[model samples]
Target: MSYSEILSFVQFIHYFTIIIFLTFNITNVLSIYEVGVDYHAFGTNFTETAFLTQYHISNVRSIVLVQLQGIADRGANFVTLDIWFGSEPGKITDEHWLATFPMSAQETTNLNQYAADVASIQSKIDDHRLHLNIALFWLGIADYKIGNLTEGFGSDYLNASEFTARIEKTTDCIITAISNIRCSDGTLLVQTVYLEAEVMIGAKPNQDWFISTHYPRFLNQITVAGFTPAIYFLVDAREEYILDKDYIDPQYPALNGHRCMYWVYRSLNFLKIHQLPFPKRIDFSCYIDRNTSTYANLTYHILNDADAALSVLDAPKSYGIAETYYFIDDTQRKEFGQAFALEALSNPRLSHIRFWTTPDAGGKGIHIAYPFAIEDFLPPLKKISIN
Candidate 1:
């Protein structure tokens, strides 16, 4: 594309407060979730809800389970199911814009590109049949936001019980689905699946409730259920990355800055409770573009604090689920201010460097199919290498 075209495209994306184009060396690409048909196994039924509706989960999940079982029986050292959710759900973007320009390309579409991504991944997995590392299962329900964060920005008071319940429900669904996908040798098909969600900003005490109480309980619950899944949170700090200082209102306290330190400190420090071998893990994820100033600094603090927390307690090990969600093309990668930080990132806790939330996935705002936001090429970068 010519410079003028590229510039036009960049400005157009700015029109939507979104941009794309990420090229990276992927260690393990994340698979998209497709809601299959009614699923009934282990004497429980998986049904549709407001967030996720099943189209064909049974056959897909079963095929994936059986494939993983074959791999396990073959004595693979470990297994990782790449699907981030048990049931995939599409999100709505840009209400006010769509309210005006209905004919434009911004018409809201479901996760069409994400579905295609998994379909291809499934084909590749099935074609090999012997080596199965990735299979898709979805988990998402975002109704846990506080006031002004809820739908339509109404005065929805942040109820602590309701807040925890939403996240708890989503976590339970993920665990229930994976725990039931047992191999023929009585082993669970999946050892770990990485799932993502965000805890909307609200009262500090309410956020603390999720961090201290709910996190430990979640840890034990997954361990007891023999489910090891990484629950990751992707925070949205589009305008300014604010670090919460004494119950600030304008910033998110849930897993950001000092709150993230507290989360790491109180999460039982990734150590086994009740002598369980596998501790349930959750990942802290954030977006980093060249635009934000304090993001890289905050990230550095997060990693350092996590290390300090683990070291102070002398925890046996550290969590390897830390990731950065970003999409920058080669041109931007070389010139962007975050390029130095991307190369400088040497956090041992960091694992996956994902190029995430393209227009295909509806991104931060509503979008339809576009040229710049292709997922086939916009896979994640490896943690060790940004080039």
Candidate 2:
């Protein structure tokens, strides 16, 4: 071939190769990528257990343990129980069916005993190479009922001061437990906790106290203490709370739940903007009936919004993504899981998703599924206005 013709042919081949490479790259990006699944509370119940088994069956890494209750005698593995304040006063009583197994008054008195109990549980978890997490309710600074009236006398308990004290105590116990446990490589166990919204806003506090005094105080306390905590909004997303003009007050920042999320997103975004450490996970616990169209639609919107936010910041989406394969009972498993999965498939950025209900058998339901992959993506800090 002539020299000019040879050069032209080589150039054509180069261009063709580039085009093919680009096409392949684009195709790969569009293909079905199996992200990780996060089963909230892996050991909570048979459903959680089944979900974890399925996660293993599907080869999912990164799971978040939800309210893994009952920490009585399981050793350091049962450390999760040390933080348990009975859900209600009746549950607190030994005579009631719902009553938590009585701990001797001495067991409750010795602060170190609580520490020891937690440490034992942590040790067990570490031995098995399991992850541990805790979820705390944020009852607004008020006294609330513990349980049903039929079971026990309704009593005013856990006001602001008491709740704060409990939180501090719980934090100390968890920290001690975590410190005692050694991972496979001899590293201390990493822990996470959830701060529930109802616990914060249940008292209907004025917007100022709710946001400034309560919310910021809670965040500062947890952050300064060196625990990785995430804001948990357990609201009925299907309800008209978002649309209600009076649902949230603008002056008091923390009282605004929707705004709280926006603020959190911005705060985390600011950390990314400035290259600081911030919580990498977001957990939104919705009480959707699953069978209702309203539940399906509400969850879909929230998931899509979360996906968009994560994509924009290139952060991995966490929580509300997993399928709840296990339930305390199978009453809503099929319906809920199927609905959750359908909504999950529409999002592409999900890294880990789980479907596990809590309380095992008798406790009130704790069902949540995370639908995102848990990949290590270091997001850059960005400063954004919360207003």
Candidate 3:
């Protein structure tokens, strides 16, 4: 019959098999802390085994990975087939390009293969090992080896209409491929798609084109038909993080790691700002330094601190939840306010701890953290005017 009909039939068979295979449980999938790190623990090259290892060490309920038509090609071809669950290991060979540019109905076979690939991935996530998030493509980054000036080169390098079309096709295929995936705990596992737009570390010509020119257009073009909006959020869209050395790739500013506090914190801030109106999640690629092996250790430490913070029941309540606070560490404390803030944040008893430094403190590496219990020990005070 038709390609869509064939895909539907294949999905029907897959669903039938799952119904026969898995025992239905009545428990609810509880709200899980979605702290996650991308599948970059294996250096420049990515592998499933390495992803599993990183997942375990991260102590997070979610793991992030990408399925490409090809990473280095113009059609944006890169696929993950080897470690997919419910399939023979290495049964479907990896492909560089799922479909060529100027796509046609003949590409239906490619679409079917892509759908199957996503189905396999969903199966693995349904095992409840960890939630899976797929980063569609690195927007704004260019690969010279990929396409021509007319086609606009690689993933983010494409012209507006071309990029949107490609993303629409890819997103549609992935969403259609994986149907409702229920975890053993009975929680529905909807795949999270990350619409990535970021600024890179070092300078490259036309890198900012996607960010400045295309991304705004993208916001309009992206459509969440089957998936929930809560299942998505922007990654590394803030400009300050891109320029900050502390949060960037050592070799290239664009590639970020766990050390890039802004990478996660910014998304968190966005969520807070937007109040997370829809289903949304973001995954971080953490690196302690520039080394790959340190990902697990670094992620563990951060999560451990977060876990500890969650246990606190009583912390001094402060006003101005949105207002900035300054932590003034006059104590020749070597670690200073940063250390002080870290200690307080890690304490389960304390939440809403934000720190800032005044011009005077900034000069001396000291900071002023506020909303502390000044009422308990001090007398009534009069307000002072700067003038």
Candidate 4:
């Protein structure tokens, strides 16, 4: 071949090689896993609740049992108990006294007794080599008892050094006991320390400061001291929006009539953007409703948003994941299947959506569906070799 023809042929080969390299590297790829769901509802029937608990234990085995379980399940490897006690019918008084400072000796004794009871349960969990996670929801309990902190307690009361100090003390006691427990791996049984934002700020001034101050301090104390503390966005704001009209309008801009989905989305998005450590588990107290729809929408939106952000950052695949809880029957599952299929097909960033059904009381069941994984679909950089 002539020199010019040979040069043209070489150029064709180089371009072809570059195209093949880009195709292999830039194409969409995902590693999908069959993620298990652990369901927790505060007030389901015993049989129904037991079925749900067993469902989790049978599947994930390393499941984290939360609030409703009276005793930690033998099969679970991680157990979580809420610090707020009022959720249990008999323990309402314990929650009541924990709210005030100048407690009578009886109240203090009752609180400590309840704390000891929790410790006893933790001991059982440790015996089985199960890890433990605690969800702190004092703000929800506080709101349930004291009304809005802004109007009733005022910002000063919420931010009082005395109140915060007491909270720190109670939490410290619980943490100390939990930290002593050990898992099969001989590691501390407690895997995470979680708190609600409302508990930290409670209608105090400068809402972001609630996160900036309390979250960092809590995480630092646990992490620096060699414990893993993950942050969780409390569903309290959504609950408050549903219950109190006055609480809904002024603070959360995302609530619009019956559509507050954006608000939930923004909350999660804010945490993700700030690169806060994503908790492996989450709890949603609200039942299915328009507001719940908003929560689901917000979840998908945040996942998509994360994918976009990761692509821009040129990060690897599978950057983040989120799971949600639901209670639905067979008919409801069919309806959700159709709706989710539509959402999944339309959204390129999403990988898979799965639905789960657990036996409930009276042989009935509840269904939950959520996108279990999210992979970063980034384009590969051009590869050019120099001799």
In the range 324-362, model 4's lDDT, one tens digit per residue, is 333334444334333333333344344332222222321
- Ranking 1 against 3 by lDDT, winner: 1
* Cα displacement (Å) at residue 292, model 2: 6.8
Give the clash count for model 3: 24
List candidate 4 segments past 4 Å from native. Answer: 1-77, 85-129, 140-159, 197-206, 234-302, 309-323, 328-387
Error of 3 at 302 (Å): 7.6
Whole-model lDDT for model 4 versus the true structure? Answer: 0.37
Error of 4 at 200 (Å): 12
* TM per prediction: 0.41, 0.44, 0.35, 0.44
Model 3's alpha-carbon lDDT is 0.31
Question: Candidate 2 — what's its lDDT?
Answer: 0.37
Q: What lDDT score is found at residue 107 in candidate 1?
A: 13
In candidate 1, how many Å is residue 187 off? 6.2
Model 2 ranges off by over 4 Å: 1-83, 86-128, 138-166, 197-226, 235-279, 290-299, 307-387
